[model samples]
Target: MTTKMREEIDEIPAAAARLLDTQTDLIRDCANALKKADPKTVVTIARGSSDHAAYFLKYAVELQLGLPVASLGPSLASIYEAPLKLGHAAAFAVSQSGASPDIVAMARGARAGGATTISLVNTIASPLAETADFAVDIMAGPEIAVAATKSFVNSIVAGLAIIAAWSEDKALVQAVDALPEHLQSALALDWSALLEPLREAESLYMLGRGPALAIAAEAALKCKETCELHAEAYSSAEVLHGPVSIVGRDFPVVAFAARDRAEASVAQTISKLAAGNAACFITSDKATGGEKLPFIATGHPITDALALIVPYYGFIESLSRARGFNPDKPVALKKVTETQ
Candidate 1:
């Protein structure tokens, strides 16, 4: 029987298509609001997988719009009751459940602070949605797995759509429109070569640059969440600073290098690691050293980076089962963490 996580992974393309088809108007409206606000900077609120999604958007917003994006800690509102002065900013609250108390409180706080708050959420009727000036239903359907797959993808997809519309970037709009097909291609990729090195490994490093760094972070979290393995994510350059000391012969390193400006730097980093006898693997054709894992190019840098996660989701689910853990039910975790 296929695990719920695998099933959700398989549904990613369709979920993305559903969001594009159904929520285009809502996304456009949100984009219009952002344009009207003309905020100097952007802030995001999320936790867990959703936080990783926010991280991805932070890079996207910075790269595409030249607007700095910051991730606000939810505790600022729920615990400290500190008032946020965000009148000159736009806030994006990303959540699958949209019911986490801290997340909701932060969204309300952002709106109260005069930010043009937008929510990208799976549950349309959620408190986060109600609190935002505009709520975009991610349209990922009902995800049963505790480990988020489709919803996570859809949240980023929705955010990317809004970015495309807000910036009025024709190329980005076209790229976002073609994501469903690209994601389908991404799902068919095989990264089984990673299993041999990662199966019994106690810990590993996931490396990337720019937006792919966020993908690396998500991959590391999934490794710990599903396979019960210890994984750390770092920028391709940041790892060389100190973490490189820990790498030895056969140390597993997965580098997520999208077809972007950062690809050469990422490839260079992984090549150095591979030369040092680390079991380095990369998702780029440009890497001279290390085994190249299959990846789809979605005709846009951000989309290309986002596509890396699909095959990764498949690989992690399989690794979890191989390691004798259920991907659907990781220990000490629940589907919705409603922290106060």
Candidate 2:
């Protein structure tokens, strides 16, 4: 990254991350949408890294809120792939720049089919934001890094806040307000010890399960975009399905175990891979001071949204430095990606 982008990332710790002043209003508005509408169905539209966060939101919405959630990939909604209304019930499209034509095209189709549209995006005047019936800005502010480290975390939290507001869960709403700060704390972490290890890697895998899987997916994406390395993401449970076959000593795995429910399963998965001679690193809140920590502390459940993402931001920064890649501007990617 250039000096300014690096300074901005480093400066994340200096400023206190806060809640959206409009989040309560957003909650009230989304609550109206849900109160007068169907909680039975919802659809998400996004692309690239935004799509991964959408996947995370979809799973969390379905599992936690009991809403049947479906994620609409941009390609599926594109004119080239198909012509269709993605979901007739309710639709929420999450994007950072909010100008992706594919997402806008899909939003039009959803609106045409009588679905209430909500656009959760960063820029208030963004095209996709303007196209929707309702819009909520993630409030992440101008993200200079093209890899989108902060916006992804903020989008998921905003999605969670919207769901929480509609569900009338005050705890989750409060949790969203607390999350950006929790992330600020994690972003302040000193990863100086991990430099030697990161430099020694031939390939890396960042794996997690449940809600943390969203973090793992983006971590891999960040690694690839920033370092041009062969980094991959796997659901901690899904890692056992077949990918474990390729385990070797040279492979390094960054395993995230943040949730109480899937934490044990992810731990067992980490152990399984470690026993196979894979070098493993763990991120958790329970590390003892005397022991060498493969860990980072995190706020759980709702705040886990940001807690999971902050360290990956650190990892991408380190990867960029390690490989001499500039995190500020990716070689071929633009601030607003418009893929056909």
Per TM-score, the best of the predicted structures is 1
lDDT of each: 0.95, 0.71
Compared with the true structure, the alpha-carbon lDDT of candidate 2 equals 0.71
Candidate 1: tens digits of C-alpha lDDT, residues 31-55 = 9999999999999999999999999
The positional error of residue 248 in candidate 2, measured at the CA in angstroms, is 0.9
- Report backbone clashes per prediction: 0, 1
Q: How high is each candidate's TM-score? A: 0.99, 0.89
Candidate 2 deviant stretches above 4 angstroms: 10-19, 80-88, 285-299
**Weakest ten-residue segment in model 1 by summed lDDT:** 245-254
Report how far residue 5 has shifted in candidate 2, in Å.
Answer: 3.8
* Candidate no. 2 TM-score: 0.89
Superposing every Cα of model 1 onto the true structure, what RMSD results? 0.7
